[model samples]
Target: MSRYFPHPAYAEDQPLARTILITHVGTRAITTGTIIGAGIFGTREALRRLRKAAAPSTVTASRSQLYLRVAGHSTLWTIGIVSLGLAGRMWGREEIEWQDRSWRLMENEAQLQTDDWTYGGMVAGLAATALFKRPVGWVAAVGSVGAGSVAGTLGYLGWRYGLQRREPPISE
Candidate 1:
């Protein structure tokens, strides 16, 4: 019975699993858009305020500082967003968890953990440069998080639905 749907255990539910992955991919795209939107709509004023008191500082600092600060801020923003979704563990708090299965939830939880690790690692790299008064290591951190997701999804779909094309058998 459980095989018919996405079981909440360690297993592949295929279609449903793909749906879940696509949902995340969609969600990430939306979040990236939102972050950019929010920043575009309301960052100048905030930066202005932050810079009013800091000398050798303007609304837009050097590229290196800008990268470190904004990237760091983005990391914090991600953490807050993730925390909001984690309000529900066993009881009921987070709304999204309403439909998420336990294993799926765990997998997502692990994913968040990995993201945090990545963000923190980048922070460390940036911090090291900052300590030496150098620039943020953006070059080393190329590629967005969504890149792998979209690729993985496309590959999964191709493997699942495209690799085994059917054709009529030759006449005997």
Candidate 2:
């Protein structure tokens, strides 16, 4: 039965009818808005903090120490982005699951899993760098985490919805 028109037997069952009312277009709109909103606010806050914490350039005691400092900064950046991404992911998943139970829910769950793996991998990279004391510059280290987030988001969207090459799942 259509969610908009509940089965006659469950005509008065309001919750069941409400459970799957978010259409594909509605889901896409909500997800897109959520991502944009979260990204904007998160980036704003990060930038504000960075500006407030700007330090005067000074020669490092040694190249290794400079590398370690950059690695530490990058680790912190990774943690922040991962935390923000996870928070947004959870919020988006909850919203979708509340209004969808089929393909949308499945896709959201998969996206969340992808985010989890990406974030975890970034943390593991930081750990390895710390352990090995490997030299890495700020841009490469920080940009990598940012790239992971972009990749995860785009990868699934492109795979599932790109080019509209296949039909979307039918909604009941």
Candidate 3:
């Protein structure tokens, strides 16, 4: 993935600590993968359905570049751009301040949790969508993202909140 970073003098500081990049970059890669992996499988299923519905079924239609735009695959592309930004910020030397580092670390962990929940929901949604060996589309696809996110996000929030609010139990 290509990124555009201005001359060093123009920017204040880099996002990641230069020395600690190995761990953070790996985490960033895994987080981005989680996000992409969730959406890509569903997009594949969607493509199969669109193809099957085309005339002379079983004979595949020529793949169209614009099919992605028509079928809402651009969501993945947008997320890909965001992921690149996350990856690119690790390159420069200056480190984020302690306060900012704390905040960013918390945000990264929270996002990791959310990514897990969301990916699980995405899997279940894809499984539930297939009926008669064909995908159930339209509202169903949209609902997959929506309903799963709601339930999974709620569960994740509860777990994270509890962990943050209460101390670990002592084992005597």
Candidate 4:
């Protein structure tokens, strides 16, 4: 028999699948952008604290005080938010897969969704860094913003799709 190409499997509900994918990617992009903006602010504060801590007057301060001064409230908050956001990303993976399965999504489609989310997030984060005079605070701001977005998006998706079962589109 002559070799033949295999037919591709399509999602049962193409519209639903597309919606979920688009929503995921869009949420990631917006979240990333927001976080980057926050990062700009945090980066600026961190730099200022760094500069102040390095001054001669603060040189004689105790180790703990020096550390506190270097990592002020804003800096600490930024660090915490970013850390949590990253952790949230890891936590949301299972939920993402669940949604994919619920919608009977194709592998390629899922992968594409993930890739877009990642790339968008990266670009947003970096762009924020560049927009704010190239300050280093973007690291924290982006992280916090990203973290907030992840939590918000995942919660929304899980609640909307996972909690309520919807019928897949009827194939003609």
Model 4 C-alpha lDDT per residue in residues 1-172, reported as the tens digit of each score:
0011121354342334334544444444545554454456567658979887554564554433332233333344554566566456555465545345535434433334444444444455444434433234533444433544444545545544677554334654
Q: Compared with the true structure, what per-residue lDDT tens digits does model 2 show for residues 12-120?
A: 3234423333332233332243344445545655786888965335754343344344434544554556556645654546443543443333344453444444455
**RMSD value for candidate 4:** 13.5
Model 3 stretches astray by more than 4 angstroms: 1-74, 93-116, 136-151, 158-172
Provide TM-scores for the models. 0.31, 0.27, 0.33, 0.28
What lDDT is reached at residue 105 by model 2? 37
Report the poorest 10 consecutive residues by lDDT, candidate 3.
1-10
For all candidates, what are the clash counts?
0, 0, 0, 8
Give the lDDT ranking, best first. Answer: 4, 3, 2, 1
Q: In model 1, which range of ten residues has the least summed lDDT?
A: 140-149
- Give lDDT: candidate 2, residue 167: 44
TM-score winner:
3
For lDDT, the strongest prediction is 4
Q: Candidate 4 — what's its lDDT?
A: 0.45
- Kindly provide the TM-score of model 3 when superposed on the true structure, using C-alpha atoms: 0.33
- For all candidates in order, the CA lDDT equals 0.42, 0.43, 0.44, 0.45
Q: Which stretches of candidate 1 lie over 4 Å from their true place?
A: 1-61, 88-90, 93-102, 105-172
